[model samples]
Target: MIAHNNMKSSPRLENEHEHENEPNNLIMKKLLSRCWEESRLLWRLAFPALLTELFQFSIGFVTTGFVGHLGEVELAAVSVVENILDSSAYGVLFGLGSALDTLSGQAVGAGRLERLGTYTQQSWIICSATAVALTPAFVFATPILKSFLHQPPHVSRVAGPYARWAIPRLFAHAMNIPLLMFFQAQSRVWAVTAISGAVLAAHVALTYLAVRRLGCGLRGAAVVGDISHWLIAAAQFAYMRGGCFPEAWKGFTVRSFSNLGAFVKLSLGSAVMIWLVVSIGYGSLEFWYYTTLLVLVGLLKHAKLQIDIMSVCLNYEFMTIMVALGFSTAAGIRVSNELGANRPKETKLAVVVAVSTSAFMGAIFMAFALIWRTSLPKFFSDSPKVIDGASRLGYLLAVTIFMSSIWPVLSGVAVGAGWQVPVAFINVGCYYLVGIPLGILFGFRLKHGALGIWMGMLTGTFLQMAILLAIIFRTKWEKQAELAKMRISEWGGKNENQPLIS
Candidate 1:
């Protein structure tokens, strides 16, 4: 009996010891899981990119607000010019810039440092050439504005000055996009973010002085924007030369021209994607403005005022989009890295975590929009019609926010997987072919105004979300990783035969 009791007690003691360590073990496991799920590695790369975007948008808002104070006519003119630039030139730049993310991320993942540098140089050359080739368009800005939309004579008068002042920004933007993407690809987001923030501060100060104090009006706003872009480009170039990206800058060669054909081939898809999405949006707005009828007082006091308020609301919405970009960027890096590293399970988990987190964030944004639906307009304007328009559209915006969250994250996954072409096609089909046309039909033809336009947009967004979700669910990460490895081998040569560099 004594022997049996001793044996039982020994086992019990062992169990007690395990129980004591169980909590500690659990804690360690939790930390590891969180690290894997959140992918701190990727966030370390994306945080700066996020900050850069935030600063850029914030400066834009401040400049727009300052111009709005000049009078509704000025605001309308600025808006029209901005819409054109966004839909045309800026869209093209951003679309091509996406190539940087894909190329650099994949090269980094495969540990091909030299190739990464080559890609960056090529990107700069291609974007710069495109910018230079496109300069003549700005000189004929008035004609282009007239061709696109009908506006007041005063509004048309401001277009020429705005476009001329904004011309230099195009080159700045061309350089900025690739440089920003280079840092993002290499996981140096913080540097980009810090530099961007400084530039934005300078921009706001200059804009205020030029517009408010110097009385330059819309021209001042345009000039400030151009200066900011140049500053940002210079800072980014300086950083690149300062050995911040030694791997990507080693022996800068003029190898860009050799890759021009391939670059254009890939960029065409991105360009079309951007053009379609932005054109759809611009077309919808134009249709509504032209078709909707209101009294002169209503047009001045209510219609125009509502647009200004919506612009502010849209600024907030754009911020949310930037935040979503953060998650998507992280997703892109994580997916590419894991695929390159031959870790299929981790890649799958990364996508799952990214999408889930984005969905939750969307829910939070929706709640916030819902709660602030009525009070939001007061932040920008006080007109009852403006307030009413905002309040009614708030719910629509919430839904959009949710859809946007899912859309961007999925886009990141596709980009990381080297599937940009197909994704771009999807965007074109949904946004331009389906969404905008329906928006015009409902908003203008049916006389439902902005609400009708939003509903049509919602339809497109939901369809996009569904398509992305389906792709995510059905994709086999392991197979994709295998294919990626084959592509890397074809492009960068054998890893085992090549000497590894520190």
Candidate 2:
């Protein structure tokens, strides 16, 4: 209980009446209590998510770090290919995976637990089909890289083999993403955390053996991820079958294949929204290329591969920063869950607490970036030139991290509120219409290089954040709660393709 006496309580019996008359004291007490309560809720949801992102990213980071050691060619090949994959495939596929967040989170809250399994199964079909369609891109990556990207011949050659080797990742991605998203929606993330941790360790060890001991080179490094990711997918599937989700997983059913059209439309909105959100801020590696073309065009041919080193260093920071990204995911789930249950006040509190916590996390990242501005590059490479280059990029990295801390939670609110279709269009406007064109102007016309490009992206981010704030404030929370309940009833009850009657 709050110390009511700690306030300016009038000691005299006559003055004691003044305390009760003022009323501000009680208001303050209630405000403080609500903040404390909301903070606890935010932490509980975000922390496990933080662990899940950390472990998952660690496995990929280790694989990248291994490639960073194998020579400049390997570094350039792996980094660029990974960058392309992130931009083209990962964003779309993972965004589709996030569809589970929308369907299952609300389902759990609305007490429609059995629907969670069917939703997840529906995602598998979509992601699998997507993976198959995209696999050919990897097969022909060499031609695309050489013709379109203008990379050096050696980089193209090395990337070709690795691209083919990396196709298995898509298949594994198909299996793994839905499982993790299903677990996350239900808040059964400790299982994901443990499984990811084990996978991280195994991935690191196997990558060392493949690259360092067995001399697998770039192809070997890529293959290690295939093994590691499949292992994770298999393990998580086992856990699901082993009574982890007794209510949700009612074995396999034909219902999963029943809602293809509905699932596709929903997944597309989610994919586009998430892709735009992630690509503009985090996924688009090609952003660096535009800057290089602008500022370093004079030395382009001679220094084609130099940008890879900087990319590697930048990827390192992005990977570690994934922990902060968890707030967005958690916010999405909590907001959706509360809304589904028709708890309008609870939904609003979750949003407020999530935004506040994310801002605090951003400040922490800003501090870390400033302190380790120089020393942290040493973790990725020993080249003094690369280290010095990365050090110079530190200020930008810090600002990026700070922005990342806030923007994601806003995106989460959009996700939780069932505004995916509208948000996708918003992202395109913010990222492509405003961000990219302006970034190009800054990088090319202003000759500010990567820093200027990032500045443009940051401008877009804050703009998006501002618009999201407007929407959130304008939203009728009670109406959204009602919508969530109705959506759950409609989607959970019958054929998703059929139009709902008014």
Candidate 3:
């Protein structure tokens, strides 16, 4: 009887254990399914975003390639001019437009689709006016380059005229950035990708004709660039006007022009509410930080050679940045949308998925940078000296590429959460206060030149990355969701549907 009872009890215990394991297996399966689903959603957005960035980047890449063959001096001059324009006008406009990524994204999540059009139009107004105000920088680029930045006179001469010619492109960016963000907020990435790809193809053919076949020189390149940009602006504008987003875009209304001051205040951040900072100037500071490297390189002893090599490296860096920007866009969209929908857990999951994907991609790019260190610069330059200098800087570029994979995503997260003001302060502290000074110290004082300057800047970038990571880790996603709803309410968003998660 005792042996029979023991046998029965063992079987019952085994059955109980099996029942416990069932839940564990089921949980594991559910987690894996969730991850797979999240990945699918993220890539759906990211792949198109990446293609859009690549296509857009190729326009500039093509320009550089053509411009490079003109002569090293021409390449150097154009690089300087491009840097200035990017740091100044482009930076300001892009930064201001980034607010749309947050605002429109949240609006969509909260089912306030109609507000996207108003925000976009308001962005256009602000950026256009800002473009007008910033026009003087292009007009007087030569004097500014020579006197203020201490660039070579000949380089400045070429750069100034080219900059003035490129002014039309500046205004084109003013119109284009808002539209790009507007489209991106709604996950209309494929549209952007298709349009950019078409424009890039046309741009390449036109650039080849103007610069290589027609021998139109720098002026021709500048004019072609202007045309390419305007084409993008016009195409995107037409798309928006074609009733694709009819509910969001209710045709152009006078209402967009009505709340100009309030809109500006919101876009730039309210000084009255210092705790909730959202300064668009963060973009300017970040852009200027990279531009400062070129500036510093120009001041080196072998100024021309330094400029050429640095420009080549910077161009590659910028290309990689476009990839990161793709991730950044996806991250920002996911975070903003999830928060707006009151799905804090999903937002957290989205961030994890995005960062993981970006990290994987970054690793691939780092390997590519390392492997093709010497050969990569050949695309942009024929100079052996330039090639060798860039090759030496390859490791730095690889590290930067890796860091960029994560950094921009965090920035996107910040943008999604409307934490631009804090990040802007971080940018100033890291890039300006720490990086620039250390660069000057290492480059000039220690005679390290471009390598040392870049090292210093990378240090700042690292610090910025670390701090942002910490912030993201410590963030209470639930509170962020609450903040998102509050922000939408402040913006007059009317939620048409109940939230799925709180």
lDDT of 2 by residue, 1-502 (tens): 2567645343665587877766988888887898898888777777888888888767667776788766666766776677665335766576666667787888888887888887888888988887898888799888867776666767777788888988987888788878877887887888778888898898888899999999988878888888888888898999989986788998887767766666665655435555445323232222332332222321243444455545655575555457666887788888899998999998888888888888888898889888988997766566677677778878877877787778768877877887766666666677667777777678668877656666776677667778888888788899999999888877776553442222
Q: List runs of model 2 lying over 4 Å from the truth.
A: 1-17, 21-23, 268-306, 494-502
Better of 2 and 3 by TM-score: 3
Please say which candidate is ahead in TM-score: 1 or 2.
2
lDDT of candidate model 2 versus the reference: 0.73
Per-candidate count of clashing residue pairs (backbone under 3 Å): 1, 0, 0
TM-score of 3: 0.95
Residue 456 local lDDT, model 1: 72
In candidate 2 the C-alpha lDDT for residue 213 amounts to 96
- The models' CA-based lDDT, in order, is 0.69, 0.73, 0.85
User: What's the TM-score of every candidate structure?
Assistant: 0.83, 0.88, 0.95
Assess candidate 1 and give its lDDT: 0.69
Tens-place lDDT digits, model 3, residues 1-502: 9999998899899999999999999999998898899899988888898888888877777898889988889989989988656446787887888777788999888988888888888899988998998899899999999999998888999899899998898899899989988888899879878899999999999999999999998999999999998988899999998889988888787777776666777776766353222344676666778899899988998898899898888888888888888888889999999999999999998988888888899999999999999899998888888889889999999998898778888888888888888888887788888999999999999989889999998899889888888889889999999999998887754542222111
State the TM-score for model 1.
Answer: 0.83
Best-to-worst order by lDDT is 3, 2, 1
